[model samples]
Target: MVRPWIGLVVLSLGVVAAEPPKPVRVPLKAPHESTIPEGPVGEAIRLGQKVFTNTPLHAPKYSGNALSCSSCHLDAGKAPHAAPMVGLWASFPTYLPRAGRVGTMEDRINGCFLRSMNGKPLPTGSEEMRCLLAYVWWLSKDVPVGAEVVGRGNPPLQAPAPADPERGKAVYARACAACHGEDGLGSADVPPLWGPRSFNLGAGMARTSKAAAFVKANMSGLGGSDPLSAQDAYDVSAYFTHQPRPDFPDKVKDWPKGGKPADSRY
Candidate 1:
């Protein structure tokens, strides 16, 4: 009992369907170290890399904790999804909701010092600041202006249920304690996860969701391992973020114009 409509449907099936569009991600590219220009500019770039990889050693005056910039940025800020700095130059002079104003690259860098490092802001014209800017600019040469890179920051995650610190403690002991230590103080090579040396309450990582996203993506250590489930990530993040750490007095000034995330510790 074939109908005329059935013939039309059969004909339609012969044509192939178009493929769905893929997720967009800007390829991260940076100039090779061998190509760094010879002279003061090159010197600045080199110094900047040193500062970034070992902030406490290279820029001791501004370091208030044991953590280096590479502790968070990872692979000298070249690694994606771990807050990579590649393509970052183009996105700045952007709005910062926390500060309630447009912030330049310098402001952004200083903000990390104030919150993440629990240290003081670098003077805008200081040598350390200039060198860091030059390094970032060199890294951003390949990216187009006014473009947004997909992996610029940590990916967002939502837990299925409320985060449980007790469950997180178990997860941390099994997975994280090897490198970070049971005390959370970490050794000389590893950055502390909590206590006075960790990021202050004002840093973005203090938020449960932000930390979970980071842990889910990158917390398996340099060799890499199986990724954590969203619930486990959320739970572990909740446990560590609530641990005692430095305080940021200026936190009160944040979100002045309004629009603070619900996860903010303050």
Candidate 2:
């Protein structure tokens, strides 16, 4: 009986030892590949390319100049100052120290038009605006959407209305052509308003109305002489909006990150 009891105890202990420990759950890793396909996104990118170079639609304010969105953006939509036209749509509605508020891609583009293109703003919620937005979305494929992308420098003073393109042409002849050139292809020091070096409509000047407002408040330097009236700014913006964009190279380049350069005053 003692031997039997001992054997039973050993069996019970063996059964206990054989029992498996509770299963532990491990988290799955994120997929390395993108879910979005290249076909439709590619089409949108092509459309964006056209929009970027299409200046006649916005009707930039300056005249006697052939400046277009492509002038600065370089190649279909590549440039140093502006980020790559791809995989960036996912980030926006981000905080900007320059503007002192969170902004969308539209706000960034509007800011560019006023300061860089010297153009007027496009109205909010317009078809043109949406189309431009669509293009940006296409470029940013597979990236997280609506994340903040900080800019460089205090945002250019809010853009004002565009000057009349016809009048702007005259202004270009008198005031701008010497430095920007008749083609609006600025040199290294000046930076071209339209061409490979210019910002794309989608990436730079999509929001026409906002861009206009900014120009009205400040132009020709923040506190300098020769500030343009709202109407004058609008007209000039209209003229530049209509110009052609330059073609981008096959490979896109990276833009500088964060707001403002260390050496910048504003």
Q: For each predicted model, how many residue pairs clash, with residues at least 3 apart or on different chains?
A: 0, 74
Best by lDDT: 1
- lDDT scores for all predictions? 0.87, 0.49
Q: Write the per-residue lDDT of candidate 2 for residues 1-266, one digit (tens) a residue.
A: 57998999998888844676544332212123253347855554455556567543444442112344554444434432233454456556687655557888887766555444545565567544565676666544434444333321113443343236797677555555677689977775454656655644433342333344434433433333366665655566656555665332211221234453221211
What is the model-wide C-alpha lDDT for candidate 2?
0.49
Give stretches of model 2 more than 4 Å off: 1-47, 56-66, 78-82, 144-266
What is model 1's C-alpha RMSD?
A: 7.7
On TM-score, the candidate that comes out on top is 1
* Candidate 1 least-lDDT 10 residues: 219-228
Instruction: Kindly provide the TM-score of model 2 when superposed on the true structure, using C-alpha atoms.
Output: 0.39
TM-score of 1: 0.88
